[model samples]
Target: MTPTRKRRLVAISMILFAVGVATTLTVFALQQNMTYLYTPSEILAGKVPADARFRIGGMVKDKSIERGQSLTVAFVVTDGDGDMRVEYEGILPDLFREKQSVIATGSMQGDRFVATEVLAKHDENYIPRDVAEAMGKAHQKHNVPEDAAKPSTY
Candidate 1:
């Protein structure tokens, strides 16, 4: 084969090899770090795997907190239709309170969720910015007061 043709073939082979290696690495990384979000109802319905790490988001059940020794606090998080007990051993967010929305990350053990991290949703009408406009329009349709319908700026 001509020298220029041989060089071109070698360059193309190297590019193909690099692309294959990159794709393989990306797939491996994704497999090791994938997680899913589930509501309390989905968890109770057996949609979440027992040993897989995932996120659960819902409202904190009223009067469900049980203060344990030290920094440990146990609470039940509910998504209207179902509830799951969560054990967290750290300082909870300042905004963490009854009936507030929260998202917890961890794996399930039996029927309980052993949370490794917890994040409390801020404000009452805490819709995403993109959805806020739609929510505002809907609230106006129902004649909700402007201040009452708006979320707390806190």
Candidate 2:
């Protein structure tokens, strides 16, 4: 009702509006940059957006590593329930090998995953939580023994 009161109300309203806008923009930017990790089975089942970049985690299928021209390499990643073919044209990590856990960051190109970066499990004792859980679920679905379902068995 008073001029001073009106000015104070306007200032408060503008501050609130600016804060809301900043919060909304932060959320939008985070969503755009966020990458999800999926299992090979989930990807095979069409759980990922066709053109969205994401990470796939699984064990490198035994004997599936193939070297190609230049730095190109191809391999199959399996979570025991399903497999995905991955192609990468960069130098793979030193620990990258068959029968090891790997996380490939890329997008699907038709049936195959075209990876921009490939990460190998850092050591014998460490497996990514997502990969470990996916492997355990797959093994349990197949009625595997509890001991065999452990990520340490990798």
Candidate 3:
């Protein structure tokens, strides 16, 4: 093969290699930060990874909020059919209250979830899509009418 042709081929090969490496690194970084959302029912059913971090979405169970000393709080999150206890050591959002939708990011510690961040529904009329689907699934499992599971505003 000609020297110029060989040089062009090497250059093309190097460019392809660099592109492949960049693509692989991008995917790796995304995977490291990716957090899957799980429903309370899914968590109760042991469908989540035992050690990996994830987000749990559900409604804050009524009368389940318990305030501990300092900024610690514990509450039960429910997706209608199942419940998971969540412990968080941070200031909860003002909109956070009983029966409100929430998504907590953390990992399971034994039978409970230890949350690093807690997100409350922004308004009475809005619910996260993941939480809504979870609630729908729970309702379906229990044979509860879908309307009954929805908030009164919806």
**TM-score of each model, paired residue for residue:** 0.78, 0.87, 0.90
Q: Model 1, 1-154: lDDT tens per residue?
A: 9999999999999999999999999999998798777777678778887589987777789999999999999999876666889999999999889978788889998889999998887788773342334334433544657689788986
- What lDDT score belongs to each candidate, Candidate 1 first? 0.80, 0.91, 0.93
Number of the predicted model whose TM-score against the real structure is largest:
3
- Lowest lDDT sum, 10 consecutive residues, model 3, at 137-146
Candidate 1, residue 7: the lDDT equals 100
Which sections of candidate 3 miss by over 4 Å? Answer: 142-154
Model 3 C-alpha lDDT per residue in residues 12-115, reported as the tens digit of each score:
99999999999999999999999999898888778897798999999999999999999999999998888899999999999999999999999999999999
The deviation in Å at residue 116 for candidate 3 is: 0.2
**How well does candidate 1 match the true structure in TM-score terms?**
0.78
Q: Which has the better TM-score: candidate 1, or candidate 3? A: 3
Q: Backbone clashes per model, in order?
A: 0, 0, 0
Tens digits of lDDT, candidate 2, 1-154: 9999999999999999999999999999999999898888888778898799999999999999999999999999999889999999999999999888999999999999999999999888888898898777766666768677687833
Judge candidate 3 against the unseen true structure and give its global Cα lDDT, from 0 to 1.
0.93
Candidate 1 residue-wise lDDT at 91: 92
